[model samples]
Target: MNRPAALAVLLLLAVSAGCTDTGPERTTLMVIPAGSLLYPLEDIEAAFESQHPDIDVRIEGHGSIQAIRQVTDLRREVDVVAVADASLIPDMMYRPMPEGDGNYTDWYIAFAENEVVIAYTGKSIGADEITQDNWYRILSRPDVRVGFSNPMLDACGYRALMVTALAEEYCEEPGLFEAIIGGSFDPPLQVDRTDGVAEITLPELMRPAGDKVAIRDGSIYLLSLLDAGGIDYAFEYRSVAEDHGLLWIDLPPEINLGFAEHADDYQKVHVTLGFRRFQSIGSERIGLPIVYAMTIPADAPHPDEARMFVDFVLECFQDGWPKSGTATVADKQIFR
Candidate 1:
């Protein structure tokens, strides 16, 4: 009887321990991502939690630059970092990857692709005139309002300029960049040309020649404005536009920086900016198939759980990349 009672007590203790509510002891996941990925990340989070009822997920959205800062500057304990700018993981985190040595971020997986576009609500000024053939003309209108992300903080910001520069090559209009982006200032003006190319000073924000361009931390950050009709059109990525259900004009791949073949042409207009703690982010903007890169941070609280979350993201990338339903992770990578 004494042995049976002891056994029963032990069994009761084990059952009580299992039933105790000390808050879940399961590891939680923290993911920082480009603002554009909010939607896909939502789907992933729901699926992840459902699969592993014990794990908790916390996701934060910011511009790619901001996301990098969460680790590099803010020193936040981010389990995983995903950015629309795949090269950023290599450029910013590469030194940390080799770990014990000086590798900041190693072996990131490029899992998704996107393209640039002019996203807008139909209420945009001269919506009737904003065709692919003459989108610039409409954007040049003083009443038209356009916006882009701050190049210093967002990939879309730099990509917007790349698109603007490429637009000149496509349209053969010499003053287009100056007129469209350079001209969108509080005090509008004409540019003086020198040595064939015109030079104009812009606010660090790079306002459009007219009041036409609006800038933000990330392209998707403008979604609310577009929805509320506070602003007209904005430079955004195709994935962002589709995800938000905003009307958009699809820029040609050559100008949109979506095709890998035009990488050389896209690299012509390089931008170096000061964002985050870096002394300066001096990366040449190249037009390759837009791919997103993700990595698990070295000091994530839930390293194993974060790895599980990363697996889910890679799975999503396998399908969601290229906006296609199916593509291998290797296919999505631009510089593997």
Candidate 2:
């Protein structure tokens, strides 16, 4: 009606229009993950974003320990952390998140599963002669090289050592690890003895045998190595080997540590490490069914969106990856 009132209404309408056109910005997510899960997570990311077009998902892969460190030590910004070792979240981060989040990380969800395997090409030294029975002896050959992950860095590396130790007992051989791993490993840092156990010392470097042993951060990091013939054999997860089309020798559950029933027996062999130099995780390493863990930290950038991504991952794992014209459940077939 009046000129002043008309002008006020017009200004209000313009401001409202600006707000409506912009809407709220899409949420950006950052996921720090264990290296082994890189490829699969890439698949999950694509599918996740397709399902939630408004959200943007990005991932950074590293050793599970390093993933934790990005939050704990390095102080990098991460919305969600998914680890190969579930215990790390509780052991490392439970104390630091926001209040009411006790001394240990409480919201951990374990999904899927895997067992250890020795994957090799047909050209691998003594590949044919190697069996579940004589495998350790074959890998130990002075001429044969072995590959493993860094125990202090990756779970698979530490698991490899534990599995080798278990194989010693299961095979009824006393000096198996020494004869096999000791020859190629950088020990005295972690010494191999005639006794069933080998002493593991930090700051020690294990070298490869010419071109035989090859070490990588995550088991999946060896895919290119295997393809390029950089190394003869590697210690990897059964699921990874299957995912990459590599032939793998399945160790028995007694040694594979995939079965829950053998938890006590599997716990026999352990590896200790000086994590922060102030404390040591003594005798903590053990071979167990590989169950990856996931959680959102208290300081996440987009926590609500991160939770949604994690939920989608769990759903994909349970429902299995979608394929051409069918819904296929992995049912351990992913590792077959």
Candidate 3:
């Protein structure tokens, strides 16, 4: 064999090898979750990915309602959805969906619990003196600014209002609810006492008229503003407050939406989202134990991977929740 013949043969062999060496394609799993679960999910994603290197997990955080709507309404691709409110999974995504081909999800597992509270920084007005008993009063001051998520969009928003209504009864303050939330949003919210429960009727448009209430799309969005003094205090999840290192006032069990034992009391204050997403078929979100739920959508692109991930998350919550500022041991995590 001559040198030229040998060179041509070698080149041909290299090209053949390159064409035959097809490596495995990486599988991508898309997860849309509540902003409140961002940190914990990040940890979960890291751990899950380490154990399963072939799978690539991508996550986006939004309000729980908005998160579900991304798949059901916006037609975005998602494999898994984890929401702060478990009921949202059924109420917003269940049967009679926008697609009309049955529900977006048939079931979900409730895996974690959180509490609602008033979170603030040292720079906040009356931060040195504000206590669980005095948070509402401090919020009502003429110069103080408060922040909360949009009820039309985020669970925390409506939960904030529920906490206020509950506070009114617990403190024996007749007009406390009106003083804080009413003065914040435009066309003041109306209170309809039905069967001893104060059902708050929210306006179709959530327009924040004055600077009194800094309303954002999600609760996590307010953390930066709170830290920068753009707003004094924000209504946020207890996990969020703890994770962000903010000074928070823990509301009573009845108002915090934390204790499952107080679910009946928590149900007394509900908020109706009559926004466009509801489209006249509004979901009257009654308070319940602050449970987080996750489900692989019926139309998921990667149901198997999603199921595996959900299982991993449940196990993580059972073993790692306390360190993550989440509660799961004391019947806090009701696995469904």
TM-score of each: 0.79, 0.77, 0.83
Off by over 4 Å in 3: 1-24, 96-103, 185-187, 280-283, 319-336
The candidate 2 region of ten consecutive residues with least summed lDDT is: 320-329
Global CA lDDT of candidate 3, please?
Answer: 0.78
Of the pair 1 and 3, which is ahead by TM-score?
Answer: 3
Q: What is the lDDT of residue 103 in candidate 1?
A: 53
Candidate 1, after superposition: displacement of residue 72 in Å?
Answer: 2.7
Q: lDDT: which is higher, 2 or 3?
A: 3
The candidate, 2 or 3, that scores higher on TM-score is 3
> How well is each residue in 1-336 modelled by candidate 2, as lDDT tens digits?
222333344345334434333335667798998877776776567666655656778799888877887776676778888887776677777664434444324567765556788988887778778887778778777777677776766788878877877887788887777676644544322334434444444444544445545677656567677767766778887767766777878787887756656767666666665354324233356545566778877777788888888876775565322111111223322110
Model 2: how far residue 86 lies from native, Å: 0.8
Candidate 3 minimal-lDDT segment of 10 residues: 1-10
- In order, candidate lDDTs are 0.68, 0.66, 0.78
lDDT tens readout by residue for model 3, 217-298:
8766799899789899999888788777888998888788887788889988888776556552366788787888888888
Candidate 1 residue runs with Cα over 4 Å from true position: 1-23, 96-102, 186-210, 274-277, 283-289, 322-329, 332-336
Q: How well does candidate 3 match the true structure in TM-score terms?
A: 0.83
